[model samples]
Target: MVTFAIGTDDFVVAGALPAISRDLAVSEGTTGQLVTVFSLAYAFSAPVMAVLTSRVPPRRLLGLGLTLFAALNFATALATSFEILLVLRIVTAVVAGTLSPAAFAIAGQRAEPGYAGRAIGVVAAGLTVSLAVGVPIGTWLSTRWGWHATFVAVGVFTVGALVTVAATLPRFEPVSEAGIGDRLRALRSPAILACAVTTTIGACAGLMPYIYVAPISEALTARPELLTVFIATIGVAGALGAAVGGHIADGWGPDRGMIATFGTALVVVLVWVGLHATVAPVPPVVIMGSLAVWGVAAWSNNAPMNARTLALAGPVGTEAMALNTSGLYVGMACGSAIGGLVLDRFGVTGTLLAAIGIGVCGVAAMVISVRRWPTGRPARGKAGKKARV
Candidate 1:
């Protein structure tokens, strides 16, 4: 529930950019910084928080983080200037940064043996759900009421999530063995580094087109109302992909799952680009279908990749997942920034092609990781066998 609320808060901004810009008297480009700054701050701060809070009880940290998240969102609802909103976003990012790694670590720690990937996937799926359901609802509400109403809605959701957590969540012992140095050392592992590279590239590919999806939809459909449908399709596909990815990772292993998903995404993007470039009077169904396919392939890699990070880091899975989270946000920041730049210099086709190229690099990295290191989980053929341990 906490994740669901935070995820909504993070993604709902994308759909509300026009309303926010009109209200605040800022360019839509400036409003885009809200996504970039929040991502950058969260990326850089998460690892530090993971190490600092390693010894704090999970329930305490989780509660405090959720409280801060709600408060900051409420504050965001009241902001009168763009600058104020940006600053508040940064603070909210830091608080959000604290919550995710802890939640993932808890999921990792508590999952049944051989089912860790499934647990992590459920948690991660919250973001995709926000993308699919929350963002659209928020966008519609913003259009009807105001962007302020959207933020208030997120705050309200968080309050409900907080109550649920307080009532149902179990207490967890501190990860006293984890330390800053231990966390840093995990990054030096070749497999871990490869996973991070894959994360960056895959995320870049997925988000680059996403940052400008509204305009892309407008170009394709020429009907502004259809933008909601496109957004909803992407979200729904992504949500399904995330859920399926977890089950696959639990069975076949995270590394192989990433390889498959990234490879598939690359193919889907190539087809999308070709159809988009060549098909004059392109059918709306074709464009929407491609977007949905791309969404599934791109998003399905998330949980498996995180599960792989945990497998690689062993005892420091919490710290490793923190690093993984950082990599994701960094990619998001870069993708959004670069997408904006590409939009300015070359236009939408250039942005799409750039993402396709990045997707190829991500696939190559995952390939190398699989060949060079033994992935900790079983292969698809060997899945469901009893553990040797």
Candidate 2:
């Protein structure tokens, strides 16, 4: 639920950009910076905050982070100017950065011996489900009641998440006993570094075309309403894929899971590009089918990535998870920027083609990483002394 709320808050603003621009008397381009700044802020802050708050208990930190998140959303809804809203978005993003990694760490730590992948999958699915469920609902509420209402709704959802987490989550001390220097040193491991690189590249590839999905959809279909259907389809498929990916990670090992999912994603993107380039007037069913596969392939990679990071990082898994989260947001920001540039230089076809190239690079990176660390086992140095699993 906390993941769901934070995901909703991250995505809901895109849907409300136009309304926000009109209300705040700013250009749509200017209003869009809110989304950009949030992503950048979250990307940069996650690892830093994780280290700074290393001594804080997970449950206490989660409660405090969610509380601040809720308050920020409410304050955002009340802000009168674009400047204030932008700052609020940045601050809210920092709070969210603090919450998400802790949530993942808790989920990973609490699970039984072999089931950590599935447990992490369940939590990661919240973000995908938000795309399917929360964003659409928030978008509708904003459309009807004004953009401010969307923030209010997210705030209310956050409160619910806060209460649920506080009641159900166990109180646990920090997972890693490493000093700040040791925590930073964990990033030096080959497997951890590879996992981080693959995560960043995979996220970049997955989100590049998605950020400009509207344009791609418009080019492929005449019906405007199908846009909503397409987004919802990806979200739903992504949620299912996340679960399946986690199960695969548990059964097949995280390395194979990453390889298979990323390889599948490469094919899916290639097919999408082919469909756009060769077929004139692509069938709606074909488009939907392609999107469903793309979503599954794209989102399924997340679980294995998380599992692999946790497996490799050992005692500092939480800090590694924080870095992974940062990579995701950074990739997202880069994807958006790169996608926009490609869209401007070339048409929608070019954008789809660019996604294919990016997906290929991501797959190669995963393959290289897995080959280097065949078993996806924990490291053997000082990092392994207090390994969680």
Q: Each model's TM-score? A: 0.92, 0.89
The prediction achieving the highest lDDT against the true structure is 2
Candidate 2, 168-202: lDDT as tens digits: 87777886789999988876777777777788788
Residue-level lDDT tens digits of model 1 in 1-389? 87788888877777888789899997665677788889899989987888888888888888888888899889999999999999999999998888888788778666657777777888878878887887888888788899998898888888888888899887769643766787778757777777767687778787777777776666555666666677788889989988888887987788788788877877876775676677634677877898888888877887788888877778887777777888888888888777767766776678788888887777777777778875668333245643220
Off by over 4 Å in 1: 379-389
Over the full model, what C-alpha lDDT does candidate 2 score relative to the true structure? 0.80
lDDT of 1 at 133: 82
lDDT of each: 0.79, 0.80
TM-score: model 2 vs. ground truth: 0.89
